[model samples]
Target chain A: MAVSNPFVLSTPSLLYALDLAGTFVFALSGGMAAVKHRLDLFGVLVLSFAAANTGGITRDLLIGAVPPGAVSDWHYLGVSVLAGLLTFRFPSRIREDWSPVLLFDAAGLALFAVTGAGKALAHGLNPVMATLLGMLTGIGGGMARDVLLSRVPAVLRADLYAVAALAGAAVVVGASALQLPAVPSALAGAGLCFGLRVLAMKHGWQLPVAAPADPPPGKD
Target chain B: MAVSNPFVLSTPSLLYALDLAGTFVFALSGGMAAVKHRLDLFGVLVLSFAAANTGGITRDLLIGAVPPGAVSDWHYLGVSVLAGLLTFRFPSRIREDWSPVLLFDAAGLALFAVTGAGKALAHGLNPVMATLLGMLTGIGGGMARDVLLSRVPAVLRADLYAVAALAGAAVVVGASALQLPAVPSALAGAGLCFGLRVLAMKHGWQLPVAAPADPPPGKD
Candidate 1:
């Protein structure tokens, strides 16, 4: 089998790359967040794993992939723990330098969106569902991470996060419909997502916040 | 063939009752928490649904049940939304009524623990895994609810919450091991769980907190 197509460099390898890269960056972000919250060492590791894998775990479950990959794959577990340990050891490396953190986070968000959509397609979901699942994969981790720290999910409150993921997912699903090679198509989607996220951060782009309404029942 | 077991006194009926009752109580708690947080209407409803069904959805996913029952079944959706809307409409009905909230919360916890274990057993998980899944089901909703509301999860900090659920699950699993009727075993387990939770609340029995530890890396 002379594999000339870049996509044929092994589908599993591409997926594995996406998963590990995303997991590492998200774990770092989660660990840093934990440090900011003054969590103990145990709390930091818990948050790291939760933030790194919650999205993939969620998507896999929704697609009927039992014993989610995170649970079954020792590699995912190892990467998450390593991220936590590194963050604990090198807290000063991340101090108020938000740009580097933002950049890596965007990379993770983009990669996960692409891989998530691809996985959903492989699992036989419709384009629309796959796209939505992809976006969920991108945003779910951060949501879990923030919630664990007792904060409103950043996805709901932050700038262009889910929207960017959606765009990336759409690209992946669209390319699949055109019969494009998987690796290149996924790379393009990831690039677009990462670019948009970075631009959004730089320009402070945000979805409009809902105006506060009157209190619901139980209050005067 | 005629069904002779007490467990068959309408299995679906018993399951439906447990599901609805648990959903209603948890939804109420979620709504009230939203009110406490002064979230707008959408926020309240979202929180209510998350509190009412996250646990079941989680368990179903882990067991390879795709499009979880909560997502596929409109009845569950309707009940959750109705609870949210009602809480919004009649907030006064809940004010100054801490005891009722506590009682209902305990009920939901107990029922969910039993049902969750039952589902896990049906899925062929080992007893230990089934028991853990049961505890996860009991606590998952409230943990999500508290996290969304930006509060520390009561399960981790509150009195005997997860422990009570575990005990209940153990009873149910034990009964199953002895080939007891499902209805009676479940009822016994739920009753024990509810009683233990109530006692814990009345006596302020809590899991011991971790001693305060020094900050992890990057601290002066």
Candidate 2:
């Protein structure tokens, strides 16, 4: 987005909101995974941390963001811990259905993608690298989550996960280049990505690739 | 290490040793984690995928490796499946020993660091970046391991986990530049790292960062 405001990224409260909400949702997803895996109370939080915050932490480390996400602020810790505890306290009672799980996960994914891309842009990464880093931040936690749970990655099988986050980041860069307002452009970019993902899920949409039976894969 | 034998990089025997050893050690660690978590048959293999090979897969993906690690090699799949089966059959038995687990994990860390740095060097990554990536590839699997186990990271906590890997990679690169024999230098690098790590563990050597005391009742 345009830099006219000069403080959009620097807003402390906004960062806190993103971190808290993101951590909460991520932690919840992690805890839920533990339920699926039939793990113990300790297992729930371990899965939560793996699922929720690793992406941003990985991104921060890669981009040379000193102290990284978990270390820079305690709010992320607070949210992750709370979500994990709640999930531990009431796994089945809290989330009676899978839809809420997916929705909250999607929201966290979208939020992290946009926020990650924002950080990448702030650091002046190449556009291609920026888009990739954003996608990585979005799905990295889930990948970690799935791996820990022994599930195939959600992105690999049949989801528009990475592309959604990539598109969101792409539009933000595109809009910022054209001098759009920071908040509106970010919202628009994030909204576009989120809307596409929701619609994809609603309609069971997915990317087309060669059949798995065929051994050969597509170009990188 | 010298360009005098560029063909050695793709030599069948060398590559085979690298692949088999890497897969074996990673699988051992993965299986161990599965036992710790008490996952079912499927869960054991699933965690193995995450713990054993995901680090190499991620490393490949980030470095623009085509087909990634999981898809490009059937050997990877074979190793994962075999490890999973082995884990399921002997979880109770395997869970008995600590020294064996650490030995396998340590060996895996050293091997992957060497190979990961070699790949990075092939891709012409700078020494600093290659060293960092080598460490990441070495520790990434373990980090995934610890996260799934729900503990503060072993590497992050103290000792020479990632640092040893970094040192190994650095030595490999330096040895290459000096026209040292690749096999001996590689072994030396690996030995230096693994030996130092063992020493660190035996001697209780680690850097300590002080934590803040809890605030009084009026504060957080």
Candidate 3:
């Protein structure tokens, strides 16, 4: 049986480009996080790779893609390493403004969510699970990065992080179920996710926090 | 093709018993962590499930066991949930002393390391990867639990945690390579891991901390 090499040189296309772009931004974020924590060079690279590849690696693992895509492909590894090095060398450049980071993160989230859902569907998972897995793929890397840094995961607290991913994943799954064209469905899904995230950030939209023990604000 | 049900009612043998026992103890520890963090009931249960099943789930995913052993097996889920509820209700009882929790965690680590290595070898992984996976299985649950709580993972810093797991896994993988009897090999591996962990605790053994930018101790 011939093995499929998804990241081979011959597969130069938009989707692959999007995937690498997402990975680069995520790696930059991870490296920035390491800088925030004052981690050494080794730790910076470790965090960068973890942040860049964890989502895809996790999605692949769950879907039974052995030797996970991130581990198997040298290009993915090269991209992550380069991103880490660049972030380390120009920490101030990346950290000067939080807006760029948020924008990049949103883009990565949208792209990864769509691809994650698409892969899950292709792997024979039920639609609901595929959608959830897609959201997981979008959020998993950030979660892992935060946890390793001993910080609360942004997805569990931030405005519209997972919501955007889920919305994007839903569009992909829904479109696939309805037999829509692949490229258009993917673009639509990614666009919705990105737009919603940017809007949420601009408007300060947030999911309600759990306050199981606290009395109603004024009633107490 | 016939799918194997490893956790069926009829399969209530030693391995099954060990797995359940490990899950229960890990769940208890997770619940304890949640209580310490003052998380709500829902959070406690979520932590419990993550702590109990993450090791096996991670191992299964890496080896291409789709749906994962944790997700597919009802017994494991039930045990983890029950343990969580019990821990939440009796938090005071479990918190009065730390000795029992440590002991239980050590036992779970030992058992999981052996089982993880065995499973990886069974799935035809190379010996080195199999051993590493075994260590990952032993420590993965605790790492997940700590990370979710926004704390540094104990395995990364605690006395001989990952070391003991790796040692146990090496024994299992080595013995298997040499065609040792399964039962005796497993027993030996688990015994070594548990004994090493207990000794490390008693002797206050720890991995050295990094102080990259600091001057030499004498200069300081």
The best candidate in terms of TM-score: 3
Off by over 4 Å in 3: A1-14, A40-43, A212-220, B1-49, B61-67, B71-140, B152-220
Model 1 / residue B192 / CA error / Å: 17
Best by lDDT: 1
* Ranking of all predicted structures according to DockQ, beginning with the best and ending with the worst: 1, 3, 2
lDDT of each: 0.81, 0.69, 0.79
Ten residues in sequence with the least summed lDDT for candidate 1 chain B: B1-10
Per-candidate Cα RMSD to the true structure, in Å, reads: 7.8, 13.0, 8.0
Query: lDDT per residue, candidate 3, A95-190, as tens digits?
Result: 579788888889989988988887777666667767877887888899889877867676655677888998999998898778777778888999
State the displacement of the C-alpha of residue B181, model 1, in Å, after optimal TM-score superposition: 15
Candidate 2: clashing pairs of residues: A150-B46, B1-B182
Models sorted by TM-score, best on top: 3, 1, 2
- Estimate, for each residue in B106-161, the C-alpha lDDT of model 3 and write its tens digit: 89899889888877777778889989999998899999887787766878867889
Model 2 chain B poorest 10 in a row by lDDT: B211-220
Per-model DockQ: 0.17, 0.04, 0.15
